[model samples]
Target: MTIQRHVPATDAADRAMLEGWLDYHRQTLAQKCEGLTDEQLRTASVPPSDLSLMGLVRHMADVERGWYRRVLAGEDAEPLHYDEADPDGDFHLTGTETWQEAYTTWQAEMDVARRNAAGFGLDDLARGRHRSGERFTLRWIHTHMIEEYARHNGHADLLRERLDGATGD
Candidate 1:
């Protein structure tokens, strides 16, 4: 739903490479959901897996806000798709309308994350502490986010293929 495709350059500067890859992974997630009905998107990839394309979208939105807004930008961040009442709520099927909402929220978080990252240098430390009470750098967050998307995108590929025989990069 209005997702822009991103193709990472094979050669670029450090920041460009990192940003391009993150954007590429983000677009890959959207491509996996393309042309499917909301119900199709909500369909579990495999029995007992509870993994759906919508879930990936929702989960990533939660991650983007948590890392970029709260950690990197030092801003108050509330999860857009989940909470303590149900920590796994992001992956829980809600309704047919959830497809649009997940995508919208994910896109919004991506924008915020971009803006947050833009204000910092790669080595700049975050205001927030890790669970171990260690500070994180912008570079670490960017690398982690890319890896997160990649792992989830792998799940997305399988889910999409199972959903409707669709698959691609």
Candidate 2:
């Protein structure tokens, strides 16, 4: 599918700006994976790293679940693509998962995240805590998600370029 990334407005309010940039980064990752075959999406960036576009998509799906459903909404949401036994299972594809499946899952998680966040204001405290036992404000989660997506999107840029010579912001 084609992905269109809209630039965040320069003068938007804090929450709007954060959500805008977070979504922009999310679409950036999707755009990087566009037009690639399943093999290409599953191809690792380098040996021993296991970082692939498909893996990143799966990872972000879990990330959205973790921060939004598990933390913010206080739901007992389990990781969809990973488990305690294999903490990084999302990044280690088994070749049985189709691109459409992974994309659909990621999109679904994003939808849930949006719904979960909608009930709370930016300054509201989350119902869950970090592994370190620190509580999170919705503002912090939004900022952290933006940073997380931005970093992963950078990896996606390199992976896409290596796969097909495609590169962009």
Q: Which ten residues in a row have the lowest lDDT in candidate 2?
A: 127-136
TM-score of each: 0.93, 0.97
Candidate 1, residues 116-163, lDDT tens digits: the string is 899899889997866476789999999999999999999999998888
lDDT measured at residue 137 in model 1 versus the true structure, 0 to 100: 95
> Best by lDDT, which number?
2
So what's the TM-score on candidate 1? 0.93
Instruction: List candidate 2 stretches off by more than 4 Å.
Output: none
Over 1-169, each residue of candidate 2 has an lDDT whose tens digit, in order, gives 5799999899999989999998999899999999999999999966668899999999999999999998888899888988889999999898887889999999999999999999999999999877678889999999999999999988998889888898888
Per-residue error for 145 in candidate 2, Å, reads 0.2
* Per-model CA lDDT versus the true structure: 0.86, 0.91
CA shift at 5, candidate 1, in angstroms? 3.6
* Superposition error at 108 for model 2 (Å): 0.5
**Clash pairs, model 2 backbone:** none
